[model samples]
Target: MIGRLNHVAIAVPDLDAAIATYRDTLGGEVSAIEPQAEHGVNTVFVTLPNTKIELLGALGENSPIAKFLERNPEGGIHHLCYEVEDILAARDRLLAAGARVLGSGEPRLGAHGKPVLFLHPKDFLGTLVELEQA
Candidate 1:
C-alpha cells in the first residue's frame, strides 16, 4: 500500500533560475541540491516544514523529466510520491496484479537515498504511482 507523500516533482527548464525565482517570490528554500545521473536530472528539494517540493531539470539527452515537461506544457505536478514499506514486495504484488513497472526490477536511489520504484501509470488510472521504502 502507499504511504506518506514524499514530495511532488515539478519539471522545469532551469533549476537555478527556478530556485532563485521561488525563493525571491514565494520565500521558498531549497535543500539537498543533487544530481540524479541515472535519471538524468539535476534537482533541488524545496522544503516547506511539513512537505517538500522537488524541482527537476533535464541533465542529459534523454532525461525523463524533460520529456514529461515537453508533453505536459503546463509543467506543474509531475508525480505523487508515496513512501512505501517494501519496494520489492510492492513490485511483486503489483506485477501479480498486472501492473507494469516503469524501470527495471531493481529499485533505484531516490530522494534522501531511499529506495523507490515507479509503476507504469497505464496501470494506475493514468496517475503515475511510486512505491518507496520507509
Candidate 2:
C-alpha cells in the first residue's frame, strides 16, 4: 500500500522561470533541488502542505522529459510519486500483479534524494507510477 502522496512532477521547459513563478506568484516554498545526472535532467521541488510540486526539465539529449516536452507544448504534469515503505516489496507486488518496470530495478536518487523507480504506465492503465522507499 502507498504511504503518502509524496509529490507530483511537472515537466516544464524553463526550470528557473517555473521556480520563480511558483515561488513569487503562486506562493510555494522550495523543498529540494537536485540534478538527476542519470536522467540528464535538473529538478526543482516546491513544497506544499500534504503534497509537493516537482518541476522537471532536461539537461541533455538523453533526457526522457525533454522528449515528453517535445510532443506536448506548454510543459505539463509528468508523473505522480507516492511514498512507500519498501520499494522492492512494492515492485515485487506490482510485478506479480502484471505490472512492468520501465527501467532497471536499481534505485536512483530521486527528487528528495531518496531512492525511486518508475513503473511502466502501459501496465498501470496509463498512470505512470513511481515507487519510493521511505
Candidate 3:
C-alpha cells in the first residue's frame, strides 16, 4: 500500500536555471545538486512546508531524462513519488494486482537514500509512479 506523498519529480533541460527559478525566483530553499550516476540524473531538492520538489537533469546523453527532454524540450513533471512502509511488500501487492514494475523489479537507492521502485507509467494512468520506502 502507498503512504504519504513523497516528492514530485520534474525533468529540466537546464539544471542551473531550474535551481535558480526555485531558489531565487520562487524563494524556495534549494538543496545542493547531487549527481546520481546510477540513476543517470543530477538532482536538486527544493524543500517546502508540506513536501519537496525534485529537480532532475540528465547526467549523460544516455540518461532517461535526456529522452524525456527530447520529447518535451521545456521539461515537465516526470513522476510522483509516494512513500511506502514496506517497499517489497508493496511491490508484491502491486504485482498481484496486475501492475507492472519498471527496471529489474527491485528497489534502488533513491535521492533521499531510501529504497525506491518505479512502476510502469501505463499502469498508473500514464503517470509514472515511484514508491519510496519510509
TM-score of each: 0.85, 0.87, 0.95
Give the per-residue lDDT of model 1 (tens digit) for 1-134. Answer: 87788888888876777788678788988765688887788888888887788888888898887778888765666777888788888888888988898857789887568898887877788877777798
All models, RMSD in angstroms: 2.0, 1.9, 1.0
Clash-forming residue pairs, model 1: 84-132
lDDT of 2 by residue, 62-109 (tens): 897877899766798889988999888888888798878777777677
Candidate 3 runs further than 4 Å off: none
Sorting all predicted structures by TM-score, with the top scorer first, yields 3, 2, 1
Evaluate model 1: give its lDDT: 0.80
- What lDDT would each prediction earn against the true structure? 0.80, 0.82, 0.93
* lDDT score, candidate 3, position 10: 98
Measured by TM-score, the strongest candidate is 3
Position 2, candidate 1: lDDT:
76
Weakest ten-residue segment in model 1 by summed lDDT:
71-80
Which ten-residue region of model 2 has the weakest summed lDDT?
30-39
